[model samples]
Target: MNTLTSSAHLVNVDIELEAAVLGVVLQTPGKAADLLRYIQKPTIFYHSLHQHIYEAIADLYAQGNDCDLMAVRQWLKSHGHDTTNLFNIISQNIFFDLAPKCLILFELAVKRYLGQYGERITRMASDPTTDALQLLERVDGDIDNIMGSIQSMKRPSVNDHLKVFLNGLDGKAKNNGPFTGLSTGIRTLDEQTNGLKPGCLYILAAGTGVGKTAIAGHIVKHQILEVGNAVGFCTLEMKGSEILSRFVAAETGYSNYELDRGKGIDPYKINDAVTRLSDKPLYIWDKPIELIQLEYQASEWKRRYGIKLLVIDYLQLVKHSMVKNRYERVSEISLTFKEMAQELDIAVLALAQLNRDHDKREGWKKRPKLSDLRESGQIEQDSDGVMMLFRPHKFGLNYADSSIIITPQTLEIHIPKWRNGMPTDEDYPLLAYYDAPTNRVGSVPFPDVPF
Candidate 1:
C-alpha cells in the first residue's frame, strides 16, 4: 500500500494492530492471525522514527513524567523525528485496539497515563477468570510439547527414565537379594540401611583416615561384584586409576602397600582386579570440579551405558559456579547433588568430611555427630540418610581393644535421620575393613576384628 493510504488507513487498522500487539504481549492466544499480519513489517515507520517513539515512551516511564499528547509531540520533534506527520497521525488516529491487555501494558509503560479511573478498569480485566480444568488441559498439552522437545534435545532425566531403570533394578534386587542384602555379604550394616536405594543421597561422613573412602570403595566393589549393579565412582581427591587400583587390590586380596612398594604380592591379583573391572558395569570419573560437567557425564552414562549408582568420593570438594560463601556454596552443591540423585533416579552415595570437633572431645570416643559435618548443615538436612564411619583405632585406641572401644574396625552407620526406615542396633556397627595398601573395604565385622 502507498504511504499516504497506509497513514489514512492507520485509523481503520489501529485498533486491530493495537489489539493484536497487546494480545501477543500478554501471551494470549486466539489472535494469532492478526499478529502474524501486523509483525509482517516490523518497521513501517523509518527505523529512526520508530527508534524515537520507543525512546520517548521509555523516558516518560523512567522520569515518571505525565506528558500529555502535546508534550509527547514536542518531545518527539526535539528528538529529531519528523513530528509534522507523526503528530497529526498519532493525535487523530483513534487508538482502536486498546484492549484490556493493551491498556495494562501501556499503564506499565507510563503509569501516569493511567488516570484515577484506570485503576478500576484494570482491576476488572485483571480479575477475569477461566475454566480450571480447561486451563489445566491446555497447560498439560503445552508441557507435553515442551518436555517432548526436551527429551528429543538431550537425555531424559532419571525420574523420567525411572520406570525402565526400576524394571532393571527390580530384576537385580530380586535376583541379587539372595546373594547380597540383610542376611548375606555384610549382615549388620545391611540391616540398618538395607542395600542402598536408587535415587538416594547417602552421606558417609567421618574424620580423616577413618576408612570413609575405603568403605565407599568397598561398597562400590560389593555392589558391582556381588549385586551386579552398574556403578559411577567419582573422586575429587584421588585419581580414578588410583581409586580403581585400590578396589582391584581389595578385590584380589593384595596389600595395596605391597603393590605400591613393589614388594611381595603376586602381580596376578592386580591383573585380576583389572580384568574384573573391564567386564563390570563400573565407570569412574576422578576429576570433580565441574558440577554441570559431572551431571552431563552422569547423564551420558545413564543414557548410554546404564549407570545405576553414582558415588562421589566426598562432598566438600564438589564445586559450584554460582556460590561465593563456602558454607552457602556447599548448601547449593548439596541440593544439586540431591536433585541429581532424584533426577538420575540412581543412588548417589557421597562421602563428606566430619568436623574436627569430634576429634577434640575427651575419652577417645570419636563418633561423628550430624552437627559435625563440615561446610553446610544442609548436608544433614538434604540427605535421605546420614551414615557416619567411626573407627576407634583412628582415635589412637588399640585396634585390638574391643572392650574399651566396643568395635575397632567397625563403622557406626548412624542413621541420625532415615526418611524411609528406622535405625536399629543390628544395623549399626556395620563391619568395615580399612585395607591401608589398596584402600579396599570389606564387610569385616567389628567384633570379629583382631583388635
Candidate 2:
C-alpha cells in the first residue's frame, strides 16, 4: 500500500468553495464576524493561502477594523504574506451571497481534517515501534478531538439557546411530573437538586470505606429500573462481574458478602434477579480505561442504547497521557468529563476520592469539603454539583444535635455546592442509611431516631 498515494486519493478539498467563503468575508465584514462563530480558526481552511487570508481577516475583525478586500490585503502584505494570488482569486470569484457557502466550506474542511487524521493513523499503524494499543488510544483521542471541534463549529448562539429553553418550559408546563431530568430515587435529594439534569456533571466524593460506590450504584439502579432510562457505567476499579453482583444485591436484597464468597447463595433469588436485570438497558465497561477510551465507549453506548446517564466509578483512577503531573492530568480529565456531559447531552455522575487530609482534621471538622476533592480543585469548579459523603460513625461521632443517636450505618450526604438549585441549612446534611450487607443506600426519614 503506497501511503502517500492513498492519502492524496482520500484528501478532498474544494478550492472554489474556499474562495467563495473568503470572498464573502472580504465583501461583508460584519457577516464575516458572525460566520467566524461557525468556523473560528483559519486552519479549518484546506488551502494555505486561504488560511492566511482568513487569519488576517480574523485579526482585523478582532481589532475592530474593517475586514474588506483592501484592509485584508494591506494586513496580509504588512505581515509579509503574499496576497497577490488571494486578491486575484477573490476579485475573479465575486460571491456576493456566501452565507450557505460558508457552512459548506466548513463541512468540507472538517471532512478534509478527518481524512488527514485517518492517513496519519494508517502511517502510524505501519510503524514497527508503535504499540498497537497506544496507536489505537491516540487515534481515539484524536477522533474525539476532531468530533468536538466539528460540534463547536455548529454551536448555537444565545438566541438559539433561548429558544431551546423556552421549548423545555413548554414541555414542562404540559407534563404533570415535576422533574425534567432523571431522578435519583431519593426524594429529598431529588427535590433539592431537581434530579440530575442533562448536560451537567455531578461529583460524589468521599473517603475510603464511605460507600461512594454504593450510592452511585443506587442511583444507577434507580435510573435503569425505576425511571426506565438507559445508563452506562464505566468502572475503573472493579470488574464487570463485581459491579453486577452489587446490582444483584441491590435488586434482591441479597447479602453481597454471601454472594461474593459463594456462600449460602439462593439459586432462585439469583435467577429472579438475573431475569429482572436482563431486560434493563444497562451497559458496563469495567476494564481500566483512559479518558479518551471512556469517552469513545460512552459515545458508542449512547448511540447504540441511547444511554442517558454515565457513571465513572472514581475520577482519580481515570488515566490520561496528555499531561505528566497527576494534578494537571486530573484537572484535564475533570474538564473533559464536563465537556463530554454537555456534548453528549447526558448527566455524567463521577465518583471522586476525598484527600486524606480530612482524616487529620479535628472531630466533626473531618467531614469532607469541596476543597478536599483529591488531586485537583478543578473537579469542584467544573462539576454542576458536588456531594460529599460523610459517615459520622466512621469518625466516632455517634450523636447529632445532642439528642438523636446516629446509627453506625448513617451516611451524611453533604452538598457544599449546588449550581442550579439552592439547598437550605436543613438540607445541607441529608441523611441516608447505608446497608452494607445489601450494598444499598437509601434516604432515612426526617427526625427519625436510628437508635
Candidate 3:
C-alpha cells in the first residue's frame, strides 16, 4: 500500500511531541507564529476542545466581537464549557506550568486528525464506484473553501485588495455592458439599460390593471424566443396556463378571449402561435405563494434549461415558508429576491402592486412614484430599477383615436434607482405595444407588435 510521508510523520511520536510543545505555546499567554497550524490537523480529543475554541473565535470574528482570549474563554464557558472536563483542562492551563504539555497534546491531536483526513481522501480517490458522490463532496468542499476565502477578505484592512477586486469586477461589468441578455421588448430600453444586467433585481410597480402581467409576459416571450435565452415566470395571482395562454395569444396575434372561443380568429393563427412560441425555451411556475418552491424550481430550471431571466408575476402574492409578520415578511421576500438574482445570475423582474393611496392620487394614470410600491418601501430600496405601467386610456384619455374615446395603454420606464448607471432625469411615457397573439408585448416599437 502506497502511504504518504506526512501521514507517517503525523502518527509518529516525534511529530506528536513537537505538536504538543506548540500546542502548549499556543494556549500560553505569549503568542507564537499565530499558533493556528494545529487547527488544521486536530485529533478527536483536541478536536472536541479546540473545536469549541475555534468556533467561538469564528463567532467572534463574524460578529465583530472582541477577539481577546478572555472573551473566547467566556463564550466557551457559556456554551456548556463549564460542564466539560476539557473545559477544566483549558481553564487550568491559562498559566505557564501546563502550557508546554498542552502544546504537546495539541500537536499529537493535530497529527492524528491529519492522518485520518489523509486516509479518507485516499479512500475516496481510489474507490472508483464512489467517484460520483466523492466528486460532489469535493465540489461542495471547494465551494465552502472559496466562500471561506471570500469571507476572510472582508476586513477593513483588506479594503484596498477588495477595492482592486471590485474594480476588476466593475471592469468586467463595463466590458459586458448590461444588455447581454436583457429584454425590455423595446430596442430603446435595451439600448439604454444594456439588457437588464444579471444580478439585478428589477421591480415593476403600477396601479391595478396597468397591464403589469401583460408587459412581463411580453418580456419573457421576447427574451426566450428572440434573445434565445431560457426564462422562468412565477405567477402567483394568475394560473400558469392562463399566463402561457396569453403568451400563446400574443405570439399568435390572437386575443385570449378569441383563442378561448376558437371563433373570430382564424384556426391557422392558433397553429402559428403554437409554432412561434412552443419551440422557444421558457419555463413557468404559478404555484400558490411558494417562494421556497420558486427558488427550488429555479434551481431545477437552471440545471435543466439554463434559464437566463426570471420574472415573478407580482410581489404581494409571493408567500414564504413561515411569515410571522406580514410587513417583516415582505422585507424578507424583497431580500430573498435580491439574493436569488445574485445567486442565479439571472435577471429578476418582480412585478409589484402600487399602494391604494397611489390609486387615489391625482396623476396616477401617467406615472407611479417610488413611494407607491405597496407593503414595503424596501422593494424600492432593494430594486435595481423601478418601472411603472400607466395607461392614460384606462382613466379617460385618447392617445390613439383623437375623435373617439380611446384608452391607449401607456408604460413608463422610470429610473428611480440605477445602482450602476445614470437614472433618467424625469419619467416619460414610452410607447407600449401589446401583441394580441403569442401573448408577447413590448415598447418603443422598432419591431411592431403584430396586432
Ranking by TM-score: 2, 3, 1
| lDDT, candidate 1, at 437 | 56
Poorest lDDT segment (10 consecutive residues) of candidate 3: 1-10
lDDT of candidate 3 over 243-263, digit per residue (tens): 878877766666777878877
- Each model's TM-score? 0.58, 0.67, 0.60
How well is each residue in 403-444 modelled by candidate 1, as lDDT tens digits? Answer: 535444444556666667665442344545554655544455
Question: Which model scores highest in lDDT?
Answer: 2
Q: Give the runs in model 1 whose Cα sits over 4 Å from its true position.
A: 1-185, 396-410, 424-428, 438-440, 444-451
Residue 305 of model 2, lDDT score: 84
Name the 10 consecutive residues with the lowest summed lDDT in model 2.
Answer: 2-11
lDDT tens readout by residue for model 2, 35-68: 5545666877777778888888767654446778
- Overall lDDT per candidate, in order of appearance: 0.59, 0.78, 0.62
lDDT winner between 2 and 3, please give it: 2
Error of 1 at 287 (Å): 1.9
Put the candidates in lDDT order, highest first: 2, 3, 1
Off by over 4 Å in 2: 1-153, 424-428, 446-451
